[model samples]
Target: MGKMKNGLTGGFSGKVGTLVGSSVKGQNILRNAPKKSSKNPTAGQLSHRQKFTLVSSFLRPLNGLIKRHFGSAQKLKSKVNLALAYHLKEAVNQVEDGFVVNLSKVVISKGILQTIFVDTVAIVNKELTLTWSANLVFGSVNKTDVLTVVIYQKATESMFILEQVAERGAGECKVQLPASFEDTGYGIWIFLTDVGLVECSTSVFLGEF
Candidate 1:
């Protein structure tokens, strides 16, 4: 019985040794596996320094674009302001000539007539007057003709004759308010037919009395 037990133990040891040898060989095969070459770096694999330069170069155009847009916006605003100022000045000048006393004063000569038109709606109860002067031009042959001044106001479909003055060479005319005519815009049309054909027109706001 002891001999049989020893025989059995030795047989088990032999089988275990064979299995260990096979495992060792398999491990060695795995260790000596073929080495795979790494693929070449793609364009996406940029260095940190290169990446920073690329980002900066891309942002340069973006920065320039923003600046250009800002400049264009400022220039457009300037042009709009200029146009607005021009129209505002013209409107102010027109209204100022009728409402303001200092700015209303003007000179008219023989060859030229200055006509200021005021809307009656703006001067209904206001005491408004028109005054102008004319000078004669010297000529060798023709006699100095008197300058004729006519003030007319148009309302709806009809034109009301406010005042007319005819004098030799130089003259002045003035109209008292409240205007007897309807509250329609007044148009001062000055005509110099005596010396030469000259006409001028000015506009004013008219107020209701």
Candidate 2:
């Protein structure tokens, strides 16, 4: 009975030893096993360096487009402002003359020469009259000035002398344009005196039907 008891105790001890060894081996294997990453990255997620590089790639072009649009808007605004200012100055100048020049109704009927023509539309059944004033600041002054109005077609360089008159000081001259000059666009050139002192010239268009 003593020997049987000792054998049973040894057997129990052997079983415990085997269990402890197996547990130790299992722990070591688990520690050495490959660990899984807790988080999975999507396409949007990248390294900080990569994110900065990607953003920088698109920034330059985006900035350029924004600047280009801004510049175009600024240019258009400038042109509009300039046009407004020019008309305002012209209005102020007309006030000095008591608004004698009603350019709003002026019309050029005939193509005189090279995109220039005479304002021939009859205002109040009277032939169109062109009134001009010149302030001679320098050079030789003449009391009797030879004023020549040259007309030209807007689309062509061909020009013709519409009217030439010798007048004293500032005066008004009426021109009777032939009926054939209607419908074509024209511009005017005013030559003051024979010395080629070019005065202010402007465009004239035929009135609408």
Candidate 3:
């Protein structure tokens, strides 16, 4: 049942007869309702579903990070949706019969703020240290920008995200590995965000750890 709001002339939400009424970008939209059928999915359709599942499952854990930092949300697309669309198209590789996400090609954040350059990444004992300098081909970044680190363990699909770990000008930060993270490879990425400016920089893929 479609309820009338903003007067009878206003937009509505729900189904009436064979037509469905909805709102998009504050605009009232009416379209033919989908017909429910018991048809079996074709091979191509199934393949597409499999691909979507693969990407969605991998990125779901980073929903909070991506939804707030990926990019500006469009009329009908949220930032999380934008991220999914990007990885689905750019980061996936077609395997024998399914798809797998390319970890190196994965991007967690993207925006206008220029990020600091990471000079070196080294591991001492169980502490992972990340160091950077004021050297950028583009230009220097804001010293007040907060740093964010994302560590992904492919073997267990476990992730560690550290936000506001240090200031851009701080030069370095350390992350102590958890015992469960032992004997595993890490895909690490970093980005900087200017809290006052409400802007974030593209994440730097710092190779495997």
Candidate 4:
């Protein structure tokens, strides 16, 4: 209604009833708070939202694994969500050619496959045992590659990881499930990591054993 100096008294410089005005660096600035859009989202927006929902559904179950192996729960979740979204976006075109890919089978890193190919999952003495085919070419370059096994219990939201240096002839390993996780169902994910990226297998469920 009236121009007033903005001082400790909290006075305004211009009309304050409907639209407010303020001065910045001696320039008068007038604005109103923006309102949310009311229009329906475009088809592209809907598709993007669908993809995110699908990816998040797959990842939500892995929260325990992310927190346990990757650390910084919140940070890992955001990183995985973004990375998976990009991966799916790029793979959508490939799917048209019948090259359907499972998100769980995709690894975040690009690298030569080095880990043993898991053949079967078995239970031994209250533990999950994984058997694999050897990859002799894994470290022929003499680059250090690490083998990691991750067991995730979707039902109980529990996860465990076993890490070992990739050896030329090793073929089997076991992961002891925590006693607290007894009688809980689990999903197994194995990875082969070199100095660069990690390549992992799609999770396999071994019902409570």
Candidate 5:
């Protein structure tokens, strides 16, 4: 059953046959209802579904980062959705069993802010150091910009986020790993934000270390 907003001359809301009429963002819209099928999914469809599972699960924990710094605002899609679309297309690759996110291709934050060329990723005495050189971009790079990092622990499936760990001009930032953190393999990312924290630079993957 459907209800017409302005009699039969105007748009409607509800279901009618195979079409669904609804209002979205103050606009009337009509779309076809999804049809149920008896056929089994194809191999390619299954493969894509597995990839989606892999990427979405990995990005779930970074909701705070993505929501705040992933990208500029858009009308219909949120920042997280934009990040998901980007990773699905650019960061996922097929693996032996199913799929896995290619960490090197991942981008946690995105903007016009200038980034840096990583010269080193080293950990000694439980202290992590990230060194970089200035990289050019559309916006003027500032030495006062703050560095942000996220370390993904594969064994525990957890993340350790460091906000404003150091300044970009410092060339390197040292982080003391958690006391209980064992030195297995871990994924790391680096990005920067202005002193005010109003904008961010695109993220760089430091590979698993």
Candidate 6:
């Protein structure tokens, strides 16, 4: 065997000196070519990417809400976009045309709404109360800001058993549920929005209540 200046030498069938070369399907190929990493992405990173993409896509239609809820100024709107992109939790996912955010499992400690957590949900006499950790609203939340509540019936495959939008403050709000869905198993989701009622939280789930 004679080694060339580049170190590749001709040899027997499918053998090129130390390297292996072959013709497959009438195409010449190298067997031991430096391969690329197949599993380059960690599970955590992949999951986060998926959540971010889903949230971004869902929020596209609610740009007005983002502007109104966060602020009207262009600088404030930029902050809103960054906050939403960075503060999202892994519990976000798309369901048909809507989304489900499991609030109990979500944690948003980044961007403007730092330490924002949904702590508890209480249902009494068909009225629902949701309590959360004090939000650090960075001049984005206004008096017109509201919370949007949605109840989904998993058994009936209905995306919304009941939907309500109500005025809210920074901490919590209580709303009455329709009597019809009281006995049915339903999932609760809530998102915060401005007066425009378009911008919103990721629609965090409050479990069956």
Give per-residue CA lDDT, model 1, range 3-63, as digits (tens): 2223633322112322321122123111233355698766544443343443333223223
lDDT of 4: 0.52
TM-score for candidate 3, please give it: 0.81
Superior by lDDT: candidate 2 or candidate 5: 5
Candidate number with the higher TM-score (1 or 6): 6
TM-score of each: 0.24, 0.29, 0.81, 0.47, 0.77, 0.40
lDDT of 6: 0.52
Top TM-score hit: 3
After TM-score superposition, the amount by which residue 14's alpha carbon in candidate 5 deviates from its true location, in angstroms, is 12
- Per-residue lDDT of candidate 3, residues 1-209 (tens digit): 98677998888889988889998767889999998779999998888798899889999988998987897888888888889999988999988967888888899998988877788987667677899885444555667788998888878888878888888878889878776665478788898899663789998899886
lDDT of 2 by residue, 129-166 (tens): 66544454435545454555544433433344554454
Q: What's the C-alpha lDDT at position 61 in model 4?
A: 48
lDDT by residue for model 5 over 124-143, one digit each (tens)?
77788988874445457788
Each candidate's lDDT (Cα)? Answer: 0.31, 0.36, 0.84, 0.52, 0.85, 0.52
- Model 6 ranges off by over 4 Å: 1-116, 137-139, 158-164, 168-170
| Residue-by-residue lDDT tens digits, candidate 4, 53-163 | 655555564544442333122432444554465556653433452333353443333234444556777866667667666656643433344566656555655556555
Clashes of each: 12, 20, 0, 0, 0, 3
RMSD of each: 38.6, 35.0, 2.9, 10.8, 4.4, 15.5
Model 1 RMSD, rounded to 1 decimal: 38.6
lDDT per residue (tens digit) for residues 1-209 in model 6: 32233244532235445566654434445565454588789977776677777666544544443444443334323645654654474556557754555435432211222123578877778787777755555565554455666555545534432333445455767777666545466666566654554554454556675
For candidate 2, give the lDDT. 0.36
- Prediction 1 global C-alpha lDDT: 0.31
Regarding lDDT, does 4 or 5 come out ahead?
5
Model 5 TM-score on a 0 to 1 scale: 0.77
